[model samples]
Target: MIPVTRELVTGIKLTNYKDFIVEHLEDCPKEDKLSRLKHIWSMPKFGQLPKKPTKLKLLEHTRAYLLYLVSTTIFVDASQRSTLISYLQLLRDLDEAGKYAWGAVALAFLYRSLSKVADRESHFSGLATLL
Candidate 1:
């Protein structure tokens, strides 16, 4: 087996760190978590059920899954949540005045294009069925 070097490890982490941050930000929106997450706290018994597939279901499914994952896993403890809140604030409060790499801009454009492909206008494989 090939030996691992410090440079290799550091480069791998540096290359993917922004992606990790962006993914976390996308997965958990603070405002929505604050509002809907409390429902779990109040009830203390929420169940997960299978979802029905639909033509325009991709975006909605993504949202619901993100909410469920966030509520079920993150912010379950008050003390840990405070630390998480500080780090999230740092991401939100980026130094826009200074020059910085904006990877999310490229991701946003990519997401828009992929969403267009999912639209009925693109005709996914030139096939269409009306409900």
Candidate 2:
């Protein structure tokens, strides 16, 4: 199995994530201009799920929820206002999503973030619960 990294979670390529966002959410307004990662979605947009959602809508809602969960918790960055669209590629097929080692990925991301904090006196933004 490939080692998990912040950018390569469960085989979802960074380029694909960028492509997905550019194709889908490029028009969406971004609040953080200093963020290194591009193509992020506003957190508030995915804050709630539809009350009466269709099949497709339900899938989208679940995806949004998972995105929020991971971004804010495990893979969080300094820009808390938006979420990385990279994880959306993995959420595209929920059934297959379970096959990925999510816990390992989260651990990897946390380690990576911690390393950044240790290397520099930067603010910690990932998995504070685990610390």
Candidate 3:
């Protein structure tokens, strides 16, 4: 079980995330910057996507869906509006992504979030659904 650290999560800056989106997504926005809590293909944009997408679009959609899932559920933060795009890096190769110890990472994040609450944080984050 590996410990989750700031570097493991928040280390990837927004610029890097934007760069990744541009490099990967064919339909990436020309602005090349992430909106407040919204990434290029955020959850809200899912419905607008083509029903019959190409292979690349399917992969992109899958990645976007997974990102929404993790950001809103397991690794959720206080704002709940934005997610650390660093997770996308791991999601690049879905097959390889399964190799990660996701449960351990979620547990570690939950523990960390709980510890912050003990230190006077007003709101609880992480996988609060477990509690």
Candidate 4:
């Protein structure tokens, strides 16, 4: 472990900027993080969004970059830390279905897009293979 003054930073040592960003999701304000994530995911593609986004694409290459922020974070160990855990849990729980019907919408959009793409592009026939 790299020794600092007070806190003992665990996990793999950061050798670059991407490593630092990936390892520090708990440093930012939860609301700000969530707001940024939601803002990025707010795009509405109707049935045409084969692979769009749920919030503003903070990274040009990654659609749900905030998901990286969230996914990289772990709250199960710190179950009593803050309300952010609750929100994260809810978001996690939104796996199958939830209050926000966004998943359902996205699924339908994805199926439509995939069907259309497979029909037009023979090379992309296996929709799952494209992923």
Tens-digit per-residue lDDT, 6-103, candidate 4 = 32212343234332333332233324333222322222312133465444322322322223333223211122222222223233223321344333
lDDT value, candidate 2, whole model: 0.60
lDDT (0 to 1) per candidate: 0.31, 0.60, 0.66, 0.31
Q: How close is every model to the real structure, measured as TM-score?
A: 0.22, 0.66, 0.74, 0.20
Candidate 1 C-alpha lDDT tens digits along 18-89: 344344333333343332233333222223322664533443344344434433332222222222222232
Clashing pairs in model 1?
none
The segments of candidate 1 whose C-alpha lies over 4 angstroms from its true place after superposition are 1-34, 37-52, 77-131
RMSD of each: 19.1, 5.4, 4.6, 19.3
Deviation in Å, model 1, residue 124 alpha carbon: 48
> How does residue 64 of candidate 2 score in lDDT?
65
Residue 73 deviation, candidate 1, in Å?
1.5
Better of 3 and 4 by TM-score: 3
Arrange candidates by lDDT, descending. Answer: 3, 2, 1, 4
TM-score of 1: 0.22
Residue 52 displacement in candidate 4 (angstroms): 33
